[model samples]
Target chain A: MHIYVTDHNGKEHELEALEGWRVMEVIRDWGLPIKAECGGACACATCHVFVDPDWQDKLHAASDEEEDMLDMVPDVEDNSRLSCQILMSEELDGLKVSLAPSAKPDAEVA
Target chain B: MSEQEIVTDVVIIGAGPVGLFAVFELGLLDIKCHLIDILDKPGGQCAELYPEKPIYDIPAFPEISGQELTDNLLKQAEPFGPTYHYNRMVNELEKQDKGDYLVKTDAGETFRCKVVVIAAGGGSFQPKRPPVPNIEDYENTSVFYAVRKMDDFRDHDIVIVGGGDSALDWTLNLAPLAKSLTLVHRRDSFRAHTDSVNKMRALVEEGKINFELGQIASLEGENGQISAVNIKNADGEKSLPATRLMPFFGLTMKLGPVANWGLNLHENLIEVDTEKFATSEEGIFAIGDINYYPGKLKLILSGFHEAALMAQAAKKIIHPDEKVVFQYTTSSTKLQKKLGVK
Candidate 1:
């Protein structure tokens, strides 16, 4: 499926994601700045981002841990999801996600 | 209230890897520091959580656990004359008439120093709590953001919430220790690495771990302890019996009291000059994960580079003497000798 990823500076890139690939790997494999520090373990919230409002409903709902991590993200809104928590699917063919300017440092937010 | 004030050349506000690295850098410059932190021990989050976990990206070292790396960093900083105060949180920082800064801690101790470096990493980072009512009360009791002191939950049925690597890794670690383990993910697929996810899947296939693909709708507790977790899976909602809940869901980004420090905060990161790592305010600087610069790589090696450069700039600002030559440490001096650079 084609997914649109946006960087912190609003730069957009259209990339194809395998049917079940996590959004974080899609962005990281493309050499995006999303740290995914915990290596997409969902342990670190460094891969946090905001899903486009239009495709919010199309994506899977964030789990409790993802929700908790989003709370630590700066500029968090109703649409924030840790990119690692998002899995590519046919339903989210044209998903758009924006990287947050900063992931909450491990020390400050925990 | 009586406040004790002490003066030092530098005041580092963390005891983590980067903060300790600053002490080592300052030692090379022959500067003294007054280091403060809220934790009772050093290593910040590393000491608190995942001390035994292996880290592989520390430049020269192929792999080392968090504890070993912290020990090495501390040893490197010991000679630089850093006075460490534990269990003390910096409450505020005020500029003095003499151009220095007064750092006041929550414990009523005040430090007067010419420069301040914020090196707090994930320890100061707090986890986001579910928005369900009464969630805050369970913090540090039965609910926690991380698995601090794993033995605390030995033989207890623990429910870990998250689909990422942390959730999977911790589940694998705690699975053998806990009496029973439950992993709840928002989706059937996980985002963790292949090996860790495969291990978890194996455990699930063997019926050794209970895997729930869903969300935690609410948490019910009693006497300030979490008793059960309300989970809503794809099948339906169910109340899982939980003695201790470890939520690896992830961190939330909040600057806390530091937000009011008047530093230029962009998207929760402190804005600092790239070359000097200096914040908008004089005598104030940020490094490591808290500060971001253009073209900067956020690696431990990069943090060390920033610490050295920022320490040099700070030394020049604190003691601007044309005749004062920068002396290299034993390790750095050896490298310099080999490289033949003056």
Candidate 2:
């Protein structure tokens, strides 16, 4: 399946991601700009990305923990989702996401 | 007597998997290093977040737990003899007149290094502060999440909170140092080591330290110096004299002091070039998740590769007179000898 990742700079990268692998894992395997710092533990908000609004309903809802972490992320939009929780499947092929502007500690983001 | 400033060829911040491997890479070139991390142990996120969690894709290791990987990295870096300074955060960085970097930590130690490797995975980890109004105002002076200097509390009235290892450990440690010491916890039970708990009970019985069964409700002090704290018990509210408050709540990750270092930041991560993994600042390289670049992959294997290239660049900065010769560990006898392989 081709998983499309729109980097922070708006460059689209078409990744041949395998099934059952997470969006974060596929993005990481392709060496995308996503940090995935906690390595899909959903602990760090580095993997937070904006799901294309058109495909937002196509993917499963974000987990409670992922939502909590997304809330911690700066510049969170209604389409925000943690890429780690987004598992890749054949049906979800062509899933597009734009990397969110990475968030720092709340005090330092300014 | 003036304290001798510790000097090294390179100072790598954050003793995670990448920093440990950097020690090995730099050690091959005879470059000495000293690594610093805020955590008490090495292996930043691996050992801290998911020690028992199994990690896949760690090249050559089909299946290995995070702790196992960290232990192996420690063993791998042992021959290099890189000094490890744990439980400290780098608070300041300054370019010295001699072109070396003058690095200072919260623990009051300084280092002069020709090259700086920032492997600080997700920046410094700090203890989660309890919810108290204006609690941030008392940090560093009267309230300390970490004990940087043991002597800082000498002859002072100290009150330790929480039921964890840190609280009990500090209670026993500071009892002899403080003019008066008191430990307060909501429950009678403790979550510390059995021996430390027994020692603390002994001290309580000996009248050396007071053990109050309650939670701190409010803090009272002025000018960042805490004088007293109100404790809420089952019976009533009581106040204790406390010149210093040591709360040992568990740690949480934050960008910490690294944000103020004046490095180019993509969000909280330092921007780096993939060629040398060097940050925007000259002679300062950032690898691992703490670094950001185009198509940056935050993985241990990626960090290892970055450490390799970073060491080569660092060697040039550390010893400009010597030429950097790239060699493979498989065929190079010099590399094998450095690895102590028979």
Q: What is the TM-score of chain A alone in each candidate?
A: 0.86, 0.89
TM-score of each: 0.60, 0.65
Q: Which candidate should be chosen as best, given TM-score against the real structure?
A: 2
lDDT of 2 by residue, B78-194 (tens): 988899999788999999776789999989999988998999887777565555667788889888977879999999999998776778889998899899999987667665778
**Which ranges of candidate 1 are over 4 A from the true structure?**
A4-22, A25-42, A45-110, B1-3, B44-54, B121-123, B134-216, B219-253, B320-322, B331-342
True-structure lDDT of candidate 2 = 0.82
* Per-residue lDDT of candidate 2, residues A17-94 (tens digit): 889999988887787767565768876566778888889999988765566455344344568888889988988899
What is model 2's DockQ versus the real complex?
Answer: 0.07
Off by over 4 Å in 2: A1-104, A107-110, B1-7, B47-57, B62-66, B86-88, B96-99, B105-110, B136-142, B146-159, B171-190, B194-215, B223-228, B231-244, B318-325
Per prediction, the TM-score for chain B is: 0.64, 0.77
Q: Give candidate 2's TM-score.
A: 0.65
For B73-100, candidate 1 gives per-residue lDDT tens digits of: 9877775557999977787999888678
Clashing pairs in 2: none
